[model samples]
Target: MKIVFYGVITAIALSCNVQAAAIDFSTAWYQVAQKNDALQAKKEEVKYSQALQDAAKSLYLPNVDITGSYTHFDKPISVDTPPVGNFIPSFNVPLTNQNFAHSSLNAVLPVYTGGRITAAQDIRQAQVDEAQSNYNLATRATFTQLVQYYFGVVLAEQVYQVRLDAVDALADHLNHAVKFEQQGQIAKVERLMAQVSLDKAQIEAQKSLRDYEIAKLALTKMLKQQDSVLPTTPLFVNNSVTSVTPYLTKTLTDHPGIAILNAKREQAKGMVDMASAKHLPEVMLYGNYNLYSDDSATGELLPEWMVGVGVRIPIIERSGTSQEVVAAKSSVRQVNLLQMQMQQDLSILVEKTYAEMSQALEEYNSLASSQALSEETVVLRQKAFSQGLSTSLEVADSQLYATSIRVQRLSASYNYVKSLAQLLSVSGDIDHFMDYLQINGIEVK
Candidate 1:
């Protein structure tokens, strides 16, 4: 008994794992979004962020330099002739093959920059924020599109199945009606009705098949793969949008577009600071060690070294202060307007999605009831016709109605799922979906 129980448990566990491995819509959608071509551009944005950080740190390091120079002499002076070599200069010093070598090491350390470094660092940090915001915006847009495409394919498949079932039911009814008419149990008109119903059902089935094929192509395009038979899976839905209001508010507050503008505004302010500081003086501490060698048969002058400090007071920079100030003010104004526009747009989107979700939920529920009732009517009408108490037309009509209701139900469900996704997207909860995908172990590819 223990062995049998263990075997059953193992089988159940494997089956559960297989089911869990099925492609979840939320997971597949996010994976496709993350791997999208747009994300590549966002990744480049992240690179720009790192670049900004590097630029900011650059000013902190001391400048070190090593230099060597060679000079040729038209006429060489004889230092041995007199003191300070003055006698050789008037006594006709002869030109000779002479080479002088000098090498130096220099270092510059900034004692003060009048806030130039501070302004520069602030600008770079703002740049990083801008890049991050742009990346986030692209990511959100891609996620929205992937959700739409993924759900579209799944819903199309369901509609196709519903139409197929309709065709089968109509075929069975038509076959029965023909036998009844031949046996003189039903009128020829009733048999004709059954035939017409079958024809209509088949037509609808063909159309649904075409739609299914198109949906497959769409899904394949999104995933960047070849179209083939799609696997069956239950549609995942977040029915509790009300429960996520707090999340929605949080995301909207920190939306990437607004952040991008804020970053730009900050950069503009930094530029203004930089421009103001440009008129101020900068102090630098510098040191240098020089080595010079004079070679001779008798004796040689040894190497000499020197060190110093310097200061640069900016009395004037041609149009530097005025131009930067103007640019900075203009940039700040532009960013402020951009932020306002984005906020307004987001508000409208949130309202529209909320309305859409409400309508979709109502429609889905209505279609669910209609499908159930239509299905029951079909069963009853078919049984009544077989007993010779109901006309063939009644059975055919009920079957067609049932099939159409099923299709409507599928469409309603699909729309509801999409509306919910759109709501989540506006609120910036897409990462939640991505996390679900990673946890499921389903790789994007």
Candidate 2:
């Protein structure tokens, strides 16, 4: 029976190892970039902005229209002339017919609009800029999320391995206790205590397995993969200390959020220009050609074709163009203030994340000696128990202590990795994260 149980366990482990597909961080990010809906939406927004820009540019083109109309009068009007009674008779001259039909083709080309068109084009360009920045921001955000999920799986797997080791160690101790009690060398209570500790370890191992499965599921779903994913990148930490100054400077200069705000401010300025243009005159070149005329008089009165330059000066507007200008200026000020606040908030966030990364690294380093010591103690206690020099409880306690240290160290590494991702994301330097990983990352053993 014991052989059958051990065989089943080995088979299950082998199957799991075969089924999970190991992927590196870069490949995982590429998969996510291709599959993530939110990132695709942002890309579409950029295209939409580009279309708007084209539309704005089209405003410079002339507008052509064809119009036709028919009209009926109450009566035909004419003129009568009376001549000398004796010499000639009176005659009537026709002026117009009772019905008239006419058609015209017209074109209007803007010569100048007091900068209204220019302002509109500028605003549209700013919108394009803002859309591009937003897309970049979305990309960075997705990358950061991927980092968390990928490392989460690694950490869970490591923890589960530690739990399995603890279970194996306690099981050996329990077997020894059972044998000593049966040989009349130890009390039966000692055997029972060992059984309890082994049961507890088994329960913990089961919990860790559940956690590992959950983490794997999350990563698989993120990459839109049907098969289970195993992260090739381990949880890591850099022992070297990094300064926050460079991160802060880079964040202030290159952050997408800052770029978005700058775009908005420019858009607001464009609005102000557009509003002020309302108080100025517009110049246009207009032409009309008579396409058709049923009546000869109408054709003679309306010229065959006419062209003229037209000017429209705004004398009065009920909507108050001045108030519009004021509102637009106020918007510019508002955007400026928002930009300042965003910079401040981003700086603070960078500092906080940097500090957390440093702390996790320090904690991980500090636990190294403790982990070694605990591991050595576990081996010593197990040997002493086998020689009848130490109790089973002491061996179980040492095993549990070693397991706790391993879990804590793994947790610290995970924290460091997560914080580093966040710091890079906020600083607009997430693109360099893989470089850092390659240069500084020390994989947890």
Q: Pick the candidate with the highest lDDT.
A: 2
How well does each candidate superpose onto the true structure, as a TM-score? Answer: 0.79, 0.93
Regions more than 4 Å wrong, model 2: 1-18, 74-96
TM-score of 2: 0.93
Residues 1-445 of candidate 1: C-alpha lDDT, one tens digit per residue: 2234334434542442342223656556655766678788778878978887887888967799988877676656454334456553434333333655667787899878878798889888888888887887787777777667776767766776676677677778878888999999999999889878877776676676677667766766676654342534444433444644564575569778778888889888988888877888888888777654446321144335555678898787787688888888888898898888888887777777777777766776667678789989999998999999888888988888887777676666666666666666667777565443344422210
Model 1, global lDDT: 0.70
Q: lDDT per residue, candidate 2, 161-224, as tens digits?
A: 8887787778778878988998998889889889888788777877777788889899999999
Looking at candidate 1, the ten consecutive residues that score lowest on lDDT are 436-445
Clashes of 2: 0
What RMSD does model 2 have? 2.3
lDDT of 2 at 136: 91
